[model samples]
Target chain A: MDLLEVKDLKTYFYTYEGTVKALEGVSFSVGNRKTMGLVGETGCGKSVTALSITRLIPDPPGKIIAGSVLFKKKDLLKVSDEEIRAIRGKDISMIFQEPKSALNPVYTIGDQIAENVLLHDEDLKNLSKKEKKREAWAKSIEALRVVGIAEPERIARSYPHELSGGMCQRSMIALAMVCNPSLLIADEPTTALDVTIQAQILELMKDLIKKFDSSVLLITHNLGVVAETCDDVAVMYAGKIIEKGNVREVFKEPLHPYTKGLMEAIPSVEKRKEALKSIPGSVPNLINPPSGCRFHPRCPYVKEICKEKEPELFDGRVACWLYGGAR
Target chain B: MKLRDYIARRLLLLIPTIIGVTLVTFLLTNLMPGNPVRLLLGERAASPETIAALEAQYGLDRPLYIRYFVYLRNLFMGDLGMAIHTPFPVSTEIMARLPATIELGVTALVLATIVGIAVGIISAVRSNRLSDHVSRVFALTGVSMPVFWLGLMLLLLFYYRLGWLPGMGRLSVSIGLEHITGLHTIDAILTGNLTAFVDAVKHLILPAFCLSWLEMAMIMRITRSSMLEVIRQDYIRTARSKGLRERVVIYRHALRNAMIPTITIVGLSVGALLGGAVLTETVFAWPGIGSFMVESISFKDIPVVLGITVVLAFANIFSNLIVDILYGVLDPRVRYG
Candidate 1:
């Protein structure tokens, strides 16, 4: 069984303006030790899907309105708060987009990491306060060392504001990976970093995934990152997943017109052009999205049926009338 | 080392701040109507020779600058001069009443901080809900209600009507504890007089609550807004995602970040309270520096007023210094500078 199987997840944001249908029946499965890249443009619900998996969506505004997030055959949506809390940072941990902001400004890197270690590590449950702290501190330093942070002791003692962006991101990765979670969710983990640091963080993440043998649900808009780091890819448009398959197969074949447009839009040294090809129009507002196929507005091969009815996953890979009739 | 240097700089700055306060207070008190000598002498004040002789004896006959310089010199020597109406020195009179005021102020501050932070967190967590609305209304009433009216209302309810607690003074006439600290509650505890201690506490409740009500409301409003801002931050989400219990996330992760503004308000309230909760003290008939200071002002007793002003200035500066130190402790970024 897959490590995480998100079945027909529907998330919505109840804003003052209107109800935003952020995620509409989004579904995907991340296999054991596999990295699944959820790729899309901004506001396409990539991050929302990641948050929904762990039930981390801010409740007042955003809610996982429907569907089951089955982790290891257990429905995460159905679990009690305490049960889910135990699972989080132990069974499934998440890394966020902005590393510096994501870290508590008042605490030292060591203190923050040690906090998680103490919270989730069951062996230290019965230990005395002093012993637990010592163990947690030791584990925190080790976690930082694993993330290639030099002078882990000194770095651990330093607060988030004292560190550089790359350092903060490294600390964030250390915090997430410290408990050896089975599923690691990285939501644009390298987006706020320098280009070189971005590459470094991705490499470190790839290495850590292999070392921990953990599955990753990597959410990003950068297709290059997916091509380099992910084995499986799920391309999302607006609030729906348009295509899903092995990275190599999807990149080579590019069945969905939107996917083809996204690939063409990528800047390449070999095929230089006066201008890059972009998909027509922007991502639709999910509140009042177009009927049937969400990509039909921008798709080159739009059919009469595409405007009338939504297409189901054909062969459980692509969702378009080109693949098959609307199910 | 850095912290030590920062504290030293702050202490050095206190000199100028205190001098400024003294200068303003000195000018204001000296300019007020009514001669202290006449007030002190009473009916005998009608005799000019006695008034002049008494004024000369106290060095009040000197020119303004000379008297100011003389006052400053004596202040440095810890001689706060003589109280106009009393035989004891101004310092002695102030010292006698200092503990009573501090005991009430400290109790009120503690009550405000605990209740304020707790309700603030509750309101922020359940924002816009029925409980949040209720707390908001409670805070609004606390802020808007007149302290004297509130104090009287409390006394009327708890003391006169319900007859459950004492209404005025620190303790009953019969209940006397050893004068260790001069604060009845502490002295009672020190002497192991449980009954006196209980009596002191009952006497304390109404006035302390009245004194703290405004401070509590101010702190709650600050904490609520700060917590609301902090609750939306990425770190809070990070803390939650780290599998920490919600209590730990809200209290440990969120509260610390939210406390900077709340601390500022608390520091200000402490200074205000310690400077003498005049209205609260007056309404409760509590024998604190507040009533004493008010009396000195009416009598135009310059020395006693100056002595109280110096204490007030110190209280404000000291609270501010404590607030700065707390900022460093709460945020490392502030410590380095």
Candidate 2:
């Protein structure tokens, strides 16, 4: 069974200029113990989707208009705030892109990690304050060790600024996995790191996932990362999932033109390219998105009909007219 | 960047600043019209012998530079010199009055900080809501109103109209409690005089509140903007994503980071409050260094004016130093060399 399923999720920002449909009808799922890579360009509502699942989007300006996010056979959207909060660190955890900024500067790494462990670990709740602190400290250091941080004890006691970017990212992972969460949502976790460090973090995440048995929803614009780590891929454009399938199937035969454009845009290391192919237009303005397909303006295979009506997702492939509704 | 070394270095840096402050104040006061000897003798006394003797006695007959050196030496010896009008030592008079000013200043600071931070946090958290709007309006009115006008209005309302508080002075005339700390409230408490303590507090409320209004507004505005900026930071979002309680996310994650700048403003406001107290003290006839300085400035009491200036300058520098140390405490990125 799917570990999580989001159906017809619609989130909008009531901004001053106009209503920004940040996430309009976004839908996908991550299978049990599977890594689903949500791929998109900047401002493609990938992060918004993740925030919506956790109900962390700031209200007033941001509102979840419609959706059902089902996790472990329970509708998360319908759950009470208390219920969702209980499930957050225990059942679902998240790691962000900017590692340095993601960690609180004032707190020691151990204090931050221990906080999560103490919050979700029911057995630790009943212990005396001193005992709980001691246990949390030990568990936090263990988590640091599991993420391959050398000198976990020292690193755990250090502040975020005292650590390097890679170390901070590793610590962030440690914080996410400290509670042994069932689902891990990593939003471009390596986007802000050096290429070498990015590769190391990706490897660490893959290894830790196997050890912890936690499903991951990795959100990134890096297709290479998806190819390396994710079992399934979902391509989002202008607040909607335009294409999704098994990573191999999608990468091998990108059904949608938008996905094809993204795939071609990835510069090849073996074959020296004159200039990488980039999609024609930028992401559509969500405040006033395109009437039909969001990618139609940038799609090479755009037809007159593509501008008239939006396509619906068919089968397990894409929501594009070229496939004539996937089989 | 050891904390002890940093503190020692900051202390050492104050010597030159204090020297410079004294030097400038001494020179300026000396350069002003009216001789100290003449001011002491009065215009009606035309006897040159008496004037010369007085000038010689006070060492004012020495050359300007020599007199400046003499003054500096005396200052270093902890002698603030005699007041031209009162014949009392300037330091003694200041010592008597310093506690009152400090009591007012400290009370105003504590009140401003507590109220400002609370209001600012509420405004930021409820941004664009009714409470935010109302607080913003209150902040605006506070900034725009002059301290003297506010002081009088408060006095008229609370003292004259309601008659719930004493109109002026540190304590009621009938309550002659022995002075312990010189600060009426503390002295009253020290002497176990509850009536005097309550009376002293009643007298303090109007002036302190009047003095705090502008600073409170400044602090509130700065804190609100700072908090607004911090709450938008990626870390705040990460804190929420961790499933930490909203209170923890706001206070622990956002407020601490926001406090660095707010602390700086609070430190700056201390200097501003000291300067502002002159007007506040005059309006309320509060027996503090502020009113003493005003009286000394008007009477051309150079020694008293210079003494007060030195004290104020030191107060400003020390507060700023404290703020810097606090910055180090709040943000680990700040390292003192």
Candidate 3:
């Protein structure tokens, strides 16, 4: 069985203009110790999908209308808030895009990591305050060590502002890994770092994932990052995933026109092209998205039927007219 | 950026600020039309010989620069000169009344800060809810109402109609509790006099509430907006994702960051409360520096007015410095260089 399975997740944001269908019937699964990359352009509901799994969408403005996020055979979406909270940092943890802003500025790195450690640690419930603190401190240092940080003790004591971008990202990874969660959601984790630091962070995450044997839902727009680290890829356009397959399979033969465009858009050193290929139009405004295929407006090989009827995900590959609705 | 060096630099900067304040106060008070000598002695008693003698005694006959230097020298020598309207040292009068003002000001500050922060947090947490709407309306009313008017209304309602509180003064005439701290409540506590303490508190309630109402509203509005801004920050989301309790996420993660600006407002409001105390004290008949200043201002008592202005300026500056230090404490990113 998969470690986590999300089926038909739908999330919307009710704004003054209209209801924005941020994630419309999004579905995916992560197997044990496997990494699945959700690649999409900006505002394609990748982040919203991650937030939905944790039930972290801010209400009144945003709400998850329908979804079933199953973790360890338990439907997380159906659980009470308290139950989901208990499962959050323990069973599933998430690291964010901007590491610098992700950590509380006022707290020392150690204190923040220790906060997570203490919160999920049941054994510390009965311990004295000082004892719990000491245990948390020790665990935080250990977690920091796992993320390849040097002098974990000192780094933990330093505030987030005192650390470099790469160091802060390392600390974020340490925070997420401290609980040895079964599943980890990384939302554009290295997007804010420099190229060198980005590579280092991705390398560190890869190492940590191997050591912890945790399934990962890696959300990013960088296909290179997906190819380097992810075992499987799910391509999202507008607010829906248009394609999914093994990383090599998707890269070698991308079926969806959106997926093909994304692959061609990457600036290749070998080709030395004068201009990198880019999709013709921008993503649709989610408030009033395209009626059928979200990528229909941008799709190069658009057919009449494509504009009127939405495609369904077929056997192991895509949701497009080219697939001929074959199972 | 070291904390010690930063504090020393801030302290050094205060020297020039204090001097500037004193110089401005001296010049402005001296430049005013009314003469302290003429005001001291009434129109009926004023004679050229008496006026000249009084001018010479007070050094008002000296050049403007010379008089300013003399004022500074006397100020440095711990002498605030004498009150023209009253036969008492200006410093002595201020000292006698300073505690009353401090007690009222501090009580109002503490009450407003605690209650304002609580209400503000609730409003921000449940933004647009009924509680938020209620607090916003309350804040609107508080900001619009004048301090003196509020004090009078409270006095009329509680003291006259309800008969639940005292009408005026720090203590009732019958409560002869010896002055320990010059703060009735503290003195009462020190002497183990519960009745005196109760009477002192009763007299304090209406005035302190009136003084703090505007400040409370300002604090609540600032805190609510600050919290609303901070609660949307990425760290707040990170905190929530950590599986922290909603209260922990709101208070520990969101509120701490929100407090930086609110602390600044609190410090500024203390200075505002001192200014408001002039009206609040008059309406409640509370004997404090504000009331003393009000009386001195009417009589055109330059020495007393200047003395009070200098003290208030120092209070404002020092409180601001304290708030800066608190900023460093609350947010490690704020380092003084």
Q: Give per-residue CA lDDT, model 3, range B206-316, as digits (tens).
A: 898899989999999999999999999999889989999999998899999999999999999879999999899998889999999999999898889999988888889
The TM-scores, one per candidate, come to 0.93, 0.96, 0.96
Error of 3 at A70 (Å): 0.7
**A179-258 per-residue lDDT for model 2 (tens digits):** 88899999999999999999999999999899889999999999999999999999999999999999989999998998
Error at B79, model 3, angstroms: 1.5
Listed in order, the DockQ scores are 0.78, 0.74, 0.84
Taking the tens digit of each residue's C-alpha lDDT, what string does model 3 give over A14-61? Answer: 999999999999888999999999999899999999999999999979
> Measured by TM-score, how close is model 1 to the native structure?
0.93
Runs off by more than 4 Å, candidate 1: A122-128, A269-273, A297-302, B1-9, B31-56, B60-69, B160-163
TM-score of 3: 0.96
Q: Which DockQ value does candidate 2 get?
A: 0.74
TM-score of chain B of 1: 0.93
Better model by lDDT: candidate 1 vs candidate 2: 1
Query: Where is the poorest 10-residue window by lDDT in model 3 chain B?
Result: B1-10
